[model samples]
Target: MKSKKEKGIKYFLKKLGPGNHYPKAILYLMLVFSIPATVLNIGSDIAGMGAVSNLLIPAIPSFVFSIVFTTVLTITIIKFSYQQIAGILKWLCLSVLLYIIVPFFIKVNWMDVLKHTFIPTIKFDQDYIEILVALLGTTISPYLFFWQATMEAEDVKHKIKAVVVDKQMLRDVKTDVNTGMFASNLVMFFIILTTGIVLHGNIKDISTVDQAAKALEPVVGKLSYVCFAIGVLGTGFLAIPILAGSLSYIIAETFDWKQGLDKHFGEAKGFYITIVISLAIGLVINLTGINPMKTLVYTSILYGVTAPVMIAVILHVCNNKKVMKGHTNSLLSNILGFITLIVMTVSAVMLIYFSLHH
Candidate 1:
């Protein structure tokens, strides 16, 4: 059996053999949907910060300038090591706590929040279903699976010496993933809470940067607004490179091109160029007058639609003893994975059904 040292999503797929092309095709479909969606997501973040800039400082010109400036800034940052990027992201992620604080400043009915959160309300309307799918896509994106697998491989690759993969390592992986998910969902919850409480009736939709920043105004006056704006800028700065890098990795792995953040630009020109080209395309997208907020929604929906197939492939690989080398998924893991797959699959189906009927 092959050692699992260099394991990745592609590696597992390859285990299916050279003739079975379904997994590879699914990856290709992911790339098709992901590249444009990621670019729009990056654009939305930039536009978000631009909205903040306009609100706080009138002299900063338009969001277009913001897009150009951010693109240049991100290109410089992507050259850093994965560790360096993670260090930066650690701080940027703290900005999400700002949302958690916002709800405290306003009058919030905790009981209602909890009720809606736990019990929830389901809607079958086209618009509601569409947004639901988008939410699923954003939260459980397909590219993230590839990114996680590649990053794990990179982690193993970067070790100075060979390390044993034991039960301890598996525990660490689970802990890391669980913690990150908790943090992600925590941020999402607070964001929705703040938005629903403050902007629900006042702003029907957040189609612009100004509307986005306004969600923080009630926290502690302009100070909160400024901090929130800076946080959005920080997050955008953090997310773009990761998004670009994920796209590059997907393409590089598919083609067997040289890749890795640790490699010098000259050593991995194709890999580096893929990142640049994707970012450049994203920059061009911002200039096309597409609604950044709308672009984000559409991007999420695309991810949602593509995620079910990817999840199915992942579940297959996780249970295959030949691929895992006897380290198959625990029952709990399989249960949760199936639950996610079912939810995403059903949401995608409902989105399609509503789109056709309505």
Candidate 2:
């Protein structure tokens, strides 16, 4: 009988075999086209540490260290089994919870927070519209869609059984996804709320990750700066792998090369190489003198422009009878998904208009 590692290798090999070639090809094309955005996003996260370096470390060296640290940690994580990586990712998810607690420590107008959260406040000014585009892009990112699907497939493949999904399994998947999204958005909401209350008018501009962290000091003491920095670092550690690994997986699958986190370097040279190149590129982005915050926002703009197309493709593919095999999306899913597509489309259009006019 084959060992567990052998079975895992065989499973990924099967995924690379003839089937789902079209989707694989699309993912590969999208990955290549979005490399700049992905690398910039990663660089921005790495640069986030520089925001708090005055209290934590020296700015220049801290920024450089962040890049090296992220690259090394990402490579080490990639060398683990998917199961191990998943477990680590779960813990890293908790790091963002600091944002949730921040709002309570700051003075906030609950009424205004409620109004903004529930009611759509229309603002057509250049900066306001640009922020809207950036928010939407950062939230519904392309890398996330690919990572979840591929990771699910990896989990199933690890089971080494027929692709027969049960009702309970489907329900569990939906629940997990919904819960995760809710937590993520809730964190984002609170971060915005606290920042708006404490730092919005007080700080005219936030250019670096350290500058952003500094804003938390007057509102919630110096320790809040530490929490904010830790959150950024934790999320970056979790995110870089997904950014690079998603692209690597797509490339490996597209070319029918060996893939999966469980495989050895010799066994999956191409897969690992793609990941290394991606991280290397991201590290180089940090070395450049580009303002990390602006680069991050611009990366989000890139994602905003591309998101509508990806959403449309996902909607079509997920709803196809042949593809879904009688398990197509429900009415609720269609409604939510299409609404997302429309919002992203509108955001992208408005962003371009404002950029031209402003």
lDDT of each: 0.75, 0.76
Q: Which stretches of candidate 2 lie over 4 Å from their true place?
A: 1-29, 50-55, 160-163
Write the residue-wise lDDT of candidate 1 on 1-358 in tens digits: 4355455433443454321434567667767867766767766656665666666778876565666656675667556777777677778787778777778877778888888998978877999989899989989887788778777666655642444455766677778888999988998988778778877767777776666666556656767658767767777776777788888888997787888887778878888888888767776666666676677788899889988987888888788766676778899999999999999999999999988888
**Model 2 worst lDDT window (10 residues):** 12-21
Which 10-residue window in model 1 sums to the lowest lDDT?
A: 12-21
User: Where does model 1 exceed 4 Å of error?
Assistant: 1-23
- Candidate 2 per-residue C-alpha lDDT over 1-358 given as tens digits, one digit per residue, 9 for 90 to 100: 7777656556554644324535566765676656667778877766665444534765457655766676676668567877888898889888888778888875678887788788878888888878888889889888787787778667656654444556776677788789989988888887778778767678989887767777788877868677877877787778888888887887786677888887788889999888888777777777675677788888887887887877887888788776677778999999999999998998889888888988
lDDT of 1: 0.75
Per-candidate TM-score against the hidden true structure: 0.88, 0.90
The Cα error of candidate 1 at residue 104, in Å, is 1.2
